[model samples]
Target chain A: MQTVKMVITGPFSSGKTEFIRTVSEIDVVATERKISSEVEKIKESTTVAMDFGRITVDDDLVLFLFGTPGQKRFDFMWEILSEGMLGFIVMVDSTRPETFREARTILETFKAYAPTPYIVAANKQDSPDAWEVEDVKHALRLDPEVKIMPCVARNKESVKTVLLELLYGILAEMEKN
Target chain B: MALKGNLRDFTITQLLNLVNLARKTGSLIIEGPTDVAQVTFRDGKLAFARLGQTDSSLATILHLNQKITAGQYRVIKERAGKMTDKELGLLLINAGYLSQEDILGSVQQYFIAIIRQLYTWVDGFFRFQPDLMPPEDKITVRLDLENLIIEGSRQMKEQEQLQEEIPSLDMALKFSERPGTNLRNVSLSVEEWRVVSYINPKNTIRQIAKANKMNDLAIRRVVFSLLQAGLVQLARPEGMPVAPVTSSSSSRPGAAPLPVTNKEEQKSLVNRLISRIRSL
Candidate 1:
């Protein structure tokens, strides 16, 4: 069977795992551990290693979703997971402005890794305090051409929309070549 | 719901930029380590600010600016106790004690000073209360935030550069092994010398910063200069978490790079993925 890979990355607790789990047809394989740092106060556990999920598009095509570990120390795994991926998504917790810088860093790192199409998923858009997608784009200093889509990661429809937008970006890149 | 977050994540500059760009009218209440500040904005312009429990009364401000004498200040404080700042200002203007320009200028200066003090506060919790206006009893002024935003942006850029150079405070520092460029030969500032004395393989930069009573920006600046001078080098502190590893190359070891796909193959794959997602 032919398979394609897409990596999901962002800062700590930016909903990488949830994004993958929502759309993955198979049960996600997550290596989550109880967070021991001060971050534990925010969430009980975090992805320590990586989260794996899969989608069988059809009998002839399949897609693999890889979620990178978000903490700074786990940064080494980003390059490993990003290798040979067709595209990627940089997720941001829309309610948290502090994680914006880290999100930008991750975006830049991934861009440097490969000349691939990508999109920024502004997760947690359902939160009342969540920043607008335009504000997030401005804060991240993203180009106007780069799509920053509002996303509620837990919603299957929203996750599907983000994935479809990314596929369109890839298709455009292919047509350009 | 009110907009709120830690200052460490969204900075004052970013907050100001958002307010300016969005033309927001609100009160941004910031709770610093030891004090709380409330700065009100009108259509993105700075309208008023109060820091902690400081005296921000109109009479006090006028007196501080020498627009009113000490005797007048005391008399106003004792007799105009129940009168609002607007009422008191009108009375003063009618009695020829001060002009409108005098009162507004002094208040604006005071508010700007409070905002300048807030620029130094890197760690705090801030919330923006939408359409929260200053008390009617207090005086307010509309001062353009463009200049303040520009200055704050400059400061933020400098701080960001320093952080980029020294990404982590958990890492320790050691004297460089170069035969030349010793500390004795270099002329170091008092602050630099203070930081230099604390450099060691076991003492993390955070410890050094705490010992010297320096904040994150201050400590990063000192360490960045030392690194530039080749006087110190970063080292992982004993038993500390591993520092981030940055890869200069496209792919890291142990991860086999994917073979490049041709345009036709990529297009077909994307078309198939799109079709699947659209169907979902």
Candidate 2:
């Protein structure tokens, strides 16, 4: 069976682990530690190292999802997880517009390592205060060709839709090559 | 020359303790990635603190603490938006919503909260200028820097320990479907039971923290202890599929997977989302 490794990355509390847990067939294994500082206002615990999960895409192919810690202090793990990955999903918390800058930086960092396809998942779409997908796209300065999708990472179907999109992007890229 | 450097080298607590020991009077300004805050000290005690626009206002703090109703908060905020710090305090008192003591107490609480937050900043530049005057008529809440530092540091250390056990607040928790027998013999704290009442695999630790008005570390510590006692287990929400339901042994279903990059469909989704924002 062929294995495809994909990454789910974003800023703090951007729902990377939730997205992976939603779509993964197996339980997600995550290394989380309590954050003491002001970030405790956002969430108590944060992913310290990485979150891992896997899914079977038919008998011959399987998909593995690796979620990188949101904080920049953990950026060193980004390269480690991104290696040999087919593509990735950049999650963003729509309610926290301030995190958009970090989301862009993550996207750029991964793209620098490999020119792989990616989808910007605007999470927290259910929140009334969340930004519109168009506005998020504009704020992130995403090129027209880059796909931006709104998702509630907590929802299994929504997470599946995002993964499918990233998979499609990868397939199309593979066709080009 | 003013004392200035990255906070990483000299923590806010260390700086405050130094100033307090020397009995220096001045303003200590911290510039962080998201906000800038200035704390004035008179004779080595905290006189006043002014934070950048990103920090929560007194009204927000009051609202979060449930000291003021949402409606009352809105009115106060609308009326006090243009008022100075001193004027706002007066307005709150004159409106009969808060007594003089309440105002003072809230101010102190707000001050402590801001300092605690500043202690968490790993990357920031700090500057100290001696002999700066307090803002005009601003409420001056003098606090012993040594005591404040000790308390803040203690809380930070406690939070770090709790974080070691509790990973992320995004984790959904539920009473263990097969709880261990130890739960029957173990006594739970009032706070633990309160947290247990909220666990249903539907509420994340973050949501539970918000519901209880506790900070992240406080909630996680409670949850961590519960997990250790085998009373609760982390689980995904119900209806979330753990894996692909259908799979074949030898077929490459991904080769013909449903397409997600149809430009026309994406454009429409964006249009719908934009309309939702406009309606708001």
Candidate 3:
């Protein structure tokens, strides 16, 4: 086992958990959800610690995806997660595109540790009210210089493209080093 | 959960209190789940406000919603998209007029930061510059009970406020408006700039909010102000990021970071911010 680590992160309800579930060959272990008096529905219980899952790409390529806690408080764990990690998978909700700024906060915090390669999955572009790609890019102010791949996370084709892009991003980072 | 404003997250009510308690002139940066805003102050009044990285079209929508002022719109337009929405939101709060509901709704592009308790920030975020003299031309504001509370509670958990917006009649006049400045002359509170410097083609405002430990609305305002100031430009210069999803910023080629002289410079930056805001 080469033991390459990958992290899946995004805003709450952005299908971060679902994305990992779809890709990982093993069952994902998540935190248990308990109901509170105020909010009746089962809100996705926050992953206070981490969400663990695994996938084997080939003979020796075992990819370990550790999903992180979405609430800002859990950010302290990122330093530990990114330590010796290969890269990350950044997910997004295009319909709620502006949420991307929160992702910037984490990246900025980790700037000193090391610049990791990551792929962006603009999840839910297939939604009816999704903001146009142009609008999303302009509003989010993504760097034009970087390669941004558009993908509908639920669709296998789109998901595959994102994986490819993420892999390329990792490769590009490796080449730069 | 707390979110980052600049680089720190404030509680939902703390932001509401910041809006109610802010007295100094200049931009109050408000960071929310999605967008950012810059609220300008003049003579300790809410003068103007505008979104960060916004153009005339989107700005008009914000203005129509009573989110910013005409003067602030002009100032922000002048700066272009350099300021991020977070910075702008913080500036607006300092100048007053922006309510937690309105700002949270806009920045997150969804309703977040629900104001529960209404007490003002008995302790507002303030860092004054003793080295730089306060401008003589402006009318001296008489510090009132609210100011006292803010000053008294500067380091406390969250300032107390009765309502999310201007809770009292006096606040309306107190936070009515002030001077203004573009990114160059007026700058972020050191805390405010910390987050603005992070936005790139890779991250979404929501993701940033989730990752931050401070208040999201507060961060949005700082980003908005930076966008207004032209200090922190966005990667998507024209429209929002066109990418379907935003990734982590691919460590772009290095750009020289801003240099800070000393604590005095920081204070001076805050004071200059106050002065220019009063001018507008």
The prediction achieving the highest DockQ against the true structure is 1
lDDT of 1 by residue, A34-84 (tens): 888886448888898899999888898899999999888788888878888
Candidate 2 at residue B3, lDDT?
A: 55
Runs in model 2 deviating more than 4 A are B1-280
Q: What is the lDDT of candidate 2?
A: 0.75
| Tens-digit lDDT track of model 3 for A1-177 | 445567777765566776766666678887635433343232636666677777664464466778876665466676676666656776666665336667555545544455666665667777765544543443344566545556676565566566656665655544564
DockQ-superior candidate, 1 or 2: 1
Tell me the spans in candidate 1 whose CA falls farther than 4 Å from its real position: A33-45, A127-135, A138-145, A171-177, B93-97, B157-269
Looking at candidate 2 chain A, the ten consecutive residues that score lowest on lDDT are A168-177
Model 2 quality (TM-score): 0.40
Instruction: Write model 3 residue lDDT over B1-280, tens digit each, in one string.
Output: 0112322223323332333343434544554334454444443333344444554243444565567789867776687445445555555567675765566545332111111111222222222121222223211122223442353344233222212321221110111123453444554587665554445545554445345644533544545555454454434322443558555543434322323235454344333322322332
Superposition error at A32 for model 1 (Å): 3.9
Clashes of each: 1, 4, 144
1 or 3: which has the higher lDDT?
1
- Give fnat of each prediction, in order: 0.54, 0.00, 0.00
Q: Tell how far residue B31 is off in model 1, in angstroms.
A: 0.9
Estimate every model's Cα lDDT from 0 to 1: 0.88, 0.75, 0.49
Candidate ranking under lDDT, highest first, comes to 1, 2, 3
Any runs in candidate 3 off by more than 4 Å, and if so which? A35-42, B1-280
Name the candidate, 1 or 2, with the larger TM-score value: 1
Docking class of 1: acceptable
